[model samples]
Target: MERSQPNYRLIYHDIISIKCPGKKEECSPILNKKEISILDVIKLNMIIFGINDKETQIFNQKHRSYDESTILEILDYQAKNNLNNTQLANHFKLSRNTVAKWKKHFKNKHLHPVKAN
Candidate 1:
């Protein structure tokens, strides 16, 4: 015997109900589950929550961008603690690529100053 996949349509409706509460008009009806992918559900949730790519980018810029000193501190911590890029990323709330970039910049002595937005 094998377990069956959960019905995504029901899950979508449940998410919509949770997001909209008692507002039936605000919730969009799912006409065809076959037409909906995980990405579609994600987009729907983003719309319901008033989140867009621009807003996400702005949020990331505000939170994720680090100053030169902070970047150096991250590199120092990584070296002293013998941590990997993933660990540094998790500790600093940054991506692995960011940690790798900082390491590369530190080595190359080309660490760019974080621009004020």
Candidate 2:
């Protein structure tokens, strides 16, 4: 079994599982599901943004799928403006993973403002 780091439950899980007898295995399938698929994530994002079926277009012509590379710039822009992913996602009505995909694209160190000599 792959044990998650300590405090993972405290920090990440918002719901507590109430296991009942043999249902232990299925008690919290969301946790067991682990990785989320890209397509499902996109659909969730569309719903979050309220685009649904009404919107034919997704991304703008200037850019493509929120590719890993371009997402870095978006993350930096969000951080430089002192916005957390959750806040930005809520404000923009985007999914946390969609915002997180961009955040994961770049390590934080490189984004820091270089100090003048």
Candidate 3:
């Protein structure tokens, strides 16, 4: 279901967060399943969303060096989905600048698999 407020719905997790006790500013953690650990929670999402396991691991993950393969992956997904920079950024929970940078990179070159040393 589409939400009027996207912040209220944890679409990726398929569960909404309540307020943390006494913490008005912060929402509570997700509780749709018994997650023994963070890794387990990621695994659950992977199965539930039917997406690549890597995407599940990094869906909310941010602030790390993006490799060429990952960049190409985003480029391909954007093209396939016909998503603009704003749409891609919102969908991926990334900054608009990041999406713009990637989009430019994609337009400027061909995505080729490279051997890592």
Candidate 4:
């Protein structure tokens, strides 16, 4: 029922398009799925830069949640950039405590980087 309704919100998606060798000229979506999580909805709704200070402060106050994969991706970014928890937090607008907690929780997990630009 939920999928039946139109999603008019400007939701962000990471669609992978590939043009197979000798297959076709046009690139096709390879891994686009219909289902998306609430975390995805909030996280993907990007806050644009150059906004007024008041708006920026208001946006920063909003609560955010990340799934396991996203957490792993953030950790991967931190590792790849050789950034400490505080630096990584600053980069991602996250609390250093949260980053530290994630590091401790997913220390043994495998890396699966999901690039979000």
Best-performing candidate as measured by TM-score: 4
Residue 44 of candidate 3: its Cα lDDT? Answer: 41
lDDT of 3 by residue, 33-108 (tens): 4332333344444444446566654755664445555567666667777777677667766777986676666665
Ranking of all predicted structures according to lDDT, beginning with the best and ending with the worst: 1, 4, 3, 2
Structural similarity to truth (TM-score) of each candidate = 0.39, 0.35, 0.41, 0.52
Our tally of clashes for model 4 stands at 0
Residue-wise C-alpha lDDT for candidate 2, range 1-95, written one tens digit per residue: 97543342232233233323333343344334555333333433343343545244434312334544345555555666677777766655566
In candidate 3, list every pair of residues with a backbone clash.
Answer: none
Model 1 lDDT per residue over 1-117, tens place = 976545766776776677665533444554254555433444455556765587785675455335565567567667677777888777655787877777767864533333211
Please name the candidate that would achieve the greatest lDDT relative to the true structure: 1
Please report, in order, the local distance difference test score of every candidate based on alpha carbons: 0.59, 0.46, 0.50, 0.54
Model 2: what TM-score?
0.35
Question: How many pairs of residues in model 3 come into backbone collision?
Answer: 0
Cα lDDT tens digits, model 4, 14-92, are 2211222322122112113354544334333332122458677567646555777778877888877778787888787
Per-candidate Cα RMSD to the true structure, in Å, reads: 14.7, 14.3, 14.8, 9.8
Worst 10 residues of 2 by lDDT: 11-20
lDDT of 2 at 47: 34
Whole-model lDDT, candidate 3?
0.50
